[model samples]
Target: MNIDTIAKMLFFATVRIENHGAKSASVGTGFIMTASLENGDQCPMLVTNKHVLAGAQQLVAHFIPRKPEANVPDLGQAVAVDLPPTMYVGHPDPTVDIAVMPLAPTLLLLANKLFIQALPLSLLATELPDLYTDAIEEITFVGYPNGHRDPMNFTPIARRGITATPLQLDFGGKPMFLVDGSVFGGSSGSPVFLFNQGTYRSGPNVITAGSRIALVGIIAQTMLRNAQLPVAEEVAATAHVKFAQELNIGIAFNAKAIKESIELMVSSAGQHLATAATGDGVTELSPA
Candidate 1:
């Protein structure tokens, strides 16, 4: 399909995470990992940058009701699912900025009340053959910038960008990649995907006609440059300043790190299997 069609699918997987701190509240983007169990079941878990929920006394996920024939999702009855900090499981590595929180038993019922679409763990960018990576030229990232969203349905903003550095090479000694895009505040934890449709050239004389899509990584942070000139604020006021300007470069943590982190949690005691009845008297399936 087109970008709009792909966006619709991606939007379902994206959620706005509202964090409540002691003195202030912040908003960021997060996507759900629909972990499938071998027993024909799925686990709904929230994944976001660890720093997004850092010092968060409370976490809530804002969801929009998605309809079949709407340009934007329906927001008439938006649902805010409450997430407890106690339920969160962080990556084993203290340095990795990824964390996950399972859906509470009570909130799990909302899955039926509204359309719940989550990103399947299978889409996690696994060990793709080098040939596929060689064919990839661009990727897309979806999220809210500066905490801005579609006023109608809270749809996350989608941005298209190209890889700024070598895929295999580590950026700043981390297993991450740099994206040349206008990523800003509130975009952290956004999912970066590589999608190719129509005709594509795999090699010098190799042409392909199928579509390809995969979740390659998630937004980590924006790169910056130390400005030679003082910022406007610094020039206006007489004070010592060391401010760096946005270099327009964005960082994406490799999906491998995320996969390892979540697996570590699930393999540990973080994975829970439970069932709860929905408002319609239907039971929902969850990871155990």
Candidate 2:
């Protein structure tokens, strides 16, 4: 598959986790990465923003596949699915916004059963060229907004945007690309990709060129302007009417931080796999 196709697959893995009981909501996106199992065998792992899964006792991921043939029924329905029992969360580093979830054979099988294709783990280490080298780089962001339900309405919407700055900046110490596109509260964990300029298969598999997409960074936070008041009542008591301006904001993340998190997860997962391989009769599976 080409970059666009791969991007869609990445979006499918992105999920919206809700915790009404906890009175909080967050957005998270994940992609398959390679890791080792207890038997010292390598397996696929899921990686996403740490904040997305923070403090949740339960989690569910919704995946939407490329639409079926024109004759197929339910052409645009969103598909709701769950990760497998073998999935395990890696130690989270709050400093950086990332987390790794190890996937067991059962999870891979479950993904296969659901017809959700996992992106090649090799892409994690592939170096993305600096967007600064070019005046503009075409990109796309994918994620679930507002804990929305699934076929998330005919596959995740691919929003097109261009990098606005020649040089990228660190967002809270994570790699980030400044784009002209507007993202909202629920877009925190969206994966931003550089469009690949290449060919693709025809039909429902139509792959557009000049659209090579690379996982450059994950959406973390958007910059906003707010009045600094000692208290809400202070501004109100000063004889000023309550009003605020909503301006176009900026999104940021530390590129190096994200890279480090991914590397740590990959490295730690390998060790876990080796430990599992010893087979002392200890189950590595985390209870769902």
Candidate 3:
């Protein structure tokens, strides 16, 4: 599909999860990865940020449409499917902020056999022309923000931005842009895309040499603070009233960290495929 189309697809798979008694939370994005075993067992895996799924053994992901017409209904109205119990945790890598969860047989079936407009693996691997050259690149970021509830009813919004720099952040360090585009709390794990020619591929939107849309960073934090005035003089005088200032911020794991996690997961998966090919009854690998 085209770059614009791919951006929309990535947004649909992005979700928000509140953890730590709602005191802490994160926005995580997922993409489709289809795995084929030599023994003929083909499955689709959901790849996402590892910290997004951390702490919660059992989790739920909301799926929205890539494009929802103004006349359409909310995404929550869309059928909600429970993911199977198969969890594929990868050894957390300091360099990348990624992880993989193997789809349950049932979920895999739904993606491969039922979902109408799934993201294609081939499209993800498509190459762009001189993405890291002098060409100015435009990209779209998709994800559910704090206020967006349903996809069918509530229209998903796409934020437009350009690549200001290349992917040159220190591995395991914070990676991001100085885009005029605004993103909020729920947009943490949203995938950043770089438009190249007419197609889009996995990577940071690159604007210079050594820089490419390299799955480089995630929305980790947003700066926010609450202002409070001292209790009214009369009230303060009558009773001891205390006021405190608080700050709220957003932070995301660097995409390189995530990429490392995925590589580990893929390696483990490759082993499983090898075992399956050898007729070993679906042997699973330990988290790498």
Using TM-score as the measure, which candidate wins?
1
Better of 1 and 3 by TM-score: 1
Candidates ranked by TM-score, best first? 1, 2, 3
Comparing 1 with 2 on TM-score, the higher-scoring candidate is 1
lDDT of 1 by residue, 1-288 (tens): 222444457766788888899999988888877775544566677888998888889988888754556433455557787777556777777877888776636346665564555666666666344334552368888888888887866677888988887666677788788898988989998988876667555556777775556777889789888755544774568444567789888988887887776776666754533322212111121211
lDDT against the true structure, per candidate, is 0.71, 0.49, 0.44
Q: Compute each candidate's TM-score over C-alphas.
A: 0.82, 0.63, 0.57
How high is the lDDT of residue 102 in model 1? 66
Candidate 3 all-Cα RMSD: 9.7
| Model 2 C-alpha lDDT per residue in residues 107-213, reported as the tens digit of each score | 65454333344443323313433222244556567765443434425344456676665325443343555666766666666666654545422224444344333
lDDT of 3 by residue, 1-288 (tens): 222333334444444333332354444445555554545665466665556566654456655333243322234344444543247565464434455676645464444322222332222212222223232346556555653544444334556665444344342344433333565756655655543433343235522222223333454434455555556676667444444332332344444454445446656766433221221111111111
Question: lDDT at 108 for candidate 1?
Answer: 65
Q: How many residue pairs clash in each candidate?
A: 4, 25, 27
Residue ranges of candidate 3 with Cα displaced over 4 Å: 1-28, 35-43, 64-76, 84-86, 94-96, 104-106, 112-130, 133-137, 147-151, 163-165, 169-180, 196-217, 223-258, 270-288
Report clash pairs, candidate 1.
272-287, 272-288, 273-287, 273-288
